[model samples]
Target: MYRFLFAIDKEISYSDLKTLLKKGSGIVVDVRSKDEVDKGRISGSIHIPVENVESDMSLDSAEFKSKFGVAKPSLDSSELIFHCQLGRRGAAATEKARSLGFKNSRNYAGGYKEWSEKEGK
Candidate 1:
């Protein structure tokens, strides 16, 4: 039942993600590595870096707990949209998010390259 409902291995359109972001709720995470983030990211994305996500600690563990100061749902386990260069990492992140119980996670296939182009940056 959960698998059917929260399947994370799904691709969402770039326009859909952009609309969600403009609507002003939920989280947008960048599952890319730190070096990738250093190259510039979507202005408001939380950089969890995919490596931390694969650890036994999970993205919701002590490290982020201290950062958020609350036992809230981790970005990986929350309603979110993820993106990375070309979208592969975003797809991986969606699967991880579903494994962690996020029913509304999705991968933005167009990624940062698309975003930068749209924004003329």
Candidate 2:
């Protein structure tokens, strides 16, 4: 059920992401490493490095909760967005999240670089 919905690849633009952020409508995940995130990141985004994303892990798994400190979004959540330093990692993370049953997950293609430079993060 959930898998069918998220099977499609979706990309979110920076502007749309800003709107979503202001609305507080979804979860934003940063897929950068700790060192990169320690430098700076999008406000309100959860830190989950790409390496930590297990392809076989389910969103409801205890391991996922322990790692992110939040319950995984239900299959219907369209607000699950992922980003990274440049975008590649974020895309990978999005794929992982989808594989984990987050069918509505999306990748912020502009990433932190574009977000900070253009949006003055």
Best by TM-score: 2
Local error of candidate 1 at 79, Å? 3.4
Tens-digit lDDT track for model 1 on 24-47?
Answer: 765677887888789888876777
Error of 1 at 86 (Å): 0.7
- What's the residue-level lDDT of 50 in candidate 2? 88
Full-model lDDT for every candidate? 0.69, 0.81
Candidate 2 structure quality by residue, lDDT tens digits, 8-80: 4578998889999999778888889899889898988888778776542354557667776666777668888
Q: Candidate 2, which ten residues in sequence have the lowest lDDT sum? A: 1-10
TM agreement with the true structure for every prediction: 0.73, 0.81
Off by over 4 Å in 1: 1-9, 54-78
Clashes of 2: 1
Worst 10 residues of 1 by lDDT: 69-78
Candidate with best lDDT? 2
